[model samples]
Target: MTAIPVSAITIVGLGPGSMDDLTLEARRVLAQAAHDKQTVYFRTIIHPTVEPLKQDLPELRIESFDRLYDESDDWSSLYQQIATEVCDLALQHPIVYVVPGHPLVGETSVQLVLEQARKRGITTRIVSGLSFIEPVCNLLALDPFEVGAQIIDATNLAISHIDEVAGKIIPTIPLMIVQVYNRRLASEVKLALGECYPDEWPVKLVRAAGVGEEEAVLEMPLYELDRNNFANHLSTLYVPPVPELSALRLPETLRYITMRLRREPDGCPWDRQQTHDSLKRYVIEETYEVVEALEENDMDKLAEELGDLLLQVYLHSEVARQADEFTLGDVYEHVNAKLIRRHPHVFGTVEVDNSSQVVQNWEAIKKQERASAGVDVHNESVLDRVPQATPALMVAQEYQKRVIKTGFEFTSLQDVYAKLEEELEEIKQAASPEEQLEEIGDLLFMVAKLAGFLKVDAEEALRLANRKFRRRFQTMESLAREEERPLTSYSRPEWEKLWARAKEAIASN
Candidate 1:
């Protein structure tokens, strides 16, 4: 037994609601405080240990923050209130702040008190006791370390986004969610876990652990978790691993699978042989497939194509990992940082009147970033940022788009139209095939610039026109087939009639 300094705030745990589990040191500390007529404060007097402790030590001056719970609807605010009051009392006199379970296990009030007290130059000591984890693990007949169990706060998991939860949860391991407290929270937890876990996944509810006859363990499907009012303050839900379903449910599982596929002699030969340079084509292909799915307005195809695109990213990341260049984490970090850094109007204190202003701000931030990174900003042209491998039409449009940011644009649509006409006339006046090619290129460039002046995407406009032509031509071919005549044998008038019929059919549709 060691002496707890009378000048400091000594925090004690009353164990997991069982008097037999309470530490001798905790008992001695309370006795010592009782003898000194010092008040012992409990975070709540509702714990089973509280009434028993009072009966065991009649002279113990016990007080509690149970009234704070009744007064405040928000648990966060209630914990803060208790912490502030406890720290305030510690300033006037030595305080003994007792809570259920180990002070550090899941005691928010104890954590707050410790932080606030220390910041105010007050000393605090933690008297350890058996936490709920030990008894819960014993009841479940599993070792937490062996199962690699994740202990999550039910309140936190209940309120978090599915994506944020996905990043934390791994379905191929044991999960222990603590502080279920009530059915309402259990429902929220059920819905949250359902996002990644099957609704019918088996789970265990262990309540009042280590508290003798009051302790109960119930097994049920995850979907039925909140169907009854069995959940209480001492409840903990244990989720066992579902390895077969993990790949389909968990985001981390995909990362692990990608890594495993690249592992050694037993791994996939094709995946093992891939390099970043070789996988570049797959990235471009998957990207266009995603765009095609979007253009077709197919949600299911979009989701599937997006997964394919994501796989390419994972493949490239794995290759980089093998070469000791970078990892997937670095990719996410760089892009996330860039997004937050460039979006001042959304992330920072900056405000914008319109999207045009947002674009200007983005460009300005990019320039600042390049200059700060010691790039030769003076020698770099804005057009150099456009990827050379983009489609020809897209590349042409991007060139005009970037140059226009420097205020090199036609002030009026009439000027744009005049430039287009001038280029067309030059194309007609060309005397050689080489000059004709050059004039045609100039004409196309002028058309791209005209598209920008009209606030239209030249590439998208061309794609739409191409799709229309394909549809009309397919209709004309069907008409020719129905007439039992070959398209090659059709004369000019016949072709014109076929085209008119196809156009009329398309407009009717």
Candidate 2:
């Protein structure tokens, strides 16, 4: 056979499902190629319309290549080979390739052929047909332009990408995702969507649209998508926007208080004068109260205290906004950005083998950030990092740790005990009250340091001791009351006898 000069590679779209749906131009191009004895190839003949074409055009050299399953490992390689064979045939004669629906709409094979032919300097022509998108919209009774719709492929939906799109896209707009092939793929889509949309958000599954035996539209929650057990290669997932639930109005008393506090001229004098700095102590105090409630295992109290702590944050942010320094949004942005930056193991390429390395990297980054902000670095001591307003015992413990880090600390527990004894003797020998107070303070500081070396929290240990003393003293008071004698009227020997009884009663309990 002699090679003929190939003029053009014609690409035709064989509309969705029905033969009548094919455009006049598409039919003309396909028929012309058949008359010219050129090769006529159909991308797929799985549709009912193309099935009739095979019977009617038996002598027309019609080729239906739908038997090649897409789930095969070498599907792309098969497509490349098919395109190569078509290009080889075109070198000897003109060739026509037909694809389902519009050739430009998600038709990877058609795109491959066009691109490869262009590189080989072969002319190409594309004939458009009715796409599945229009028919799908008509069936679902949705207006894409009016409601604002986003179309995406189901294969591309991953957890991270879905989160990104969900956060940025307007919540009012609906989403239409295509190419959901199977139940496994549907499950992945559901998992990704659940990140933003509620699990109960309604979704519609559409399959093999515009065909006589096509599946009926199935509606279910996003979470129940996989449970429905209905999906195929032609399936599309439609996610509807969830409507916000109505919230109850605030109580009249609470509303009045909020209004009065926010009032420009008639607000309370003390409330109007407050700023972020003025409310800082209250924020810290409320946070500690919440922590205490949690430790006590009082769920109801914890809930109430947590709300109070949150209100402190809101109040401070509102005050800052009035001062023109920043708003709650700015505060949130800074903290969120800081968290993401500090956790490079979570958000960046930093390789951290363990939690210890993560902590070290975080501290290093924080120090660098502080240095860059022009905060004193060289002259700044670690002790200064402990906030001045922190509880005195906490500050003492923190200060001791800073000094120990600098290799200025005393040796062992025995050495610390000896120093404590020496401080006690000095307190006894002091001539002035101030000197005696200073010696006692030195003894307490040394005790705190010893507690740190022993891996004990000095504040907590002291708190427990105080509670024990209070309980024992309460028992003694109760005993005196039962004995028909007042605690203050008891003699030294009588009080000692009551104290022993209290101890015995506690041990029995």
| The best candidate in terms of TM-score | 1
Clashing pairs in 2: none
**Ten consecutive residues with minimal summed lDDT in candidate 1?**
244-253
Candidate 2: C-alpha lDDT: 0.73
lDDT of 2 by residue, 316-398 (tens): 76677777877777978999999999998899999989999987998799888999999878788777777887776777898
Candidate 2 positional error at 286, Å = 4.6
* Per-model TM values vs. the true structure: 0.84, 0.57
Cα distance off (Å), candidate 2, residue 95: 15
Which candidate leads the pack in lDDT? 1
Tens digits of per-residue lDDT, candidate 1, 1-509, equal: 34556646889998888999999989999988877777899987777898887888888999998787557765446677998999899889888999888999977778789889878999988999889999999899999998788888786687678677777787778899987878887998998898778899999999999999999999999999999999987898999988843648666777888998999988899999999888889999999999889988999999999999999988889899999999999999999999999998999999999999998899889989999999888899878878888987789888887887798878899998999999999999999999999999999888888887888898888888988999999999999999999999999999999999999999999
Rate residue 350 of model 2 by lDDT. 90
lDDT value, residue 253 of candidate 2: 27
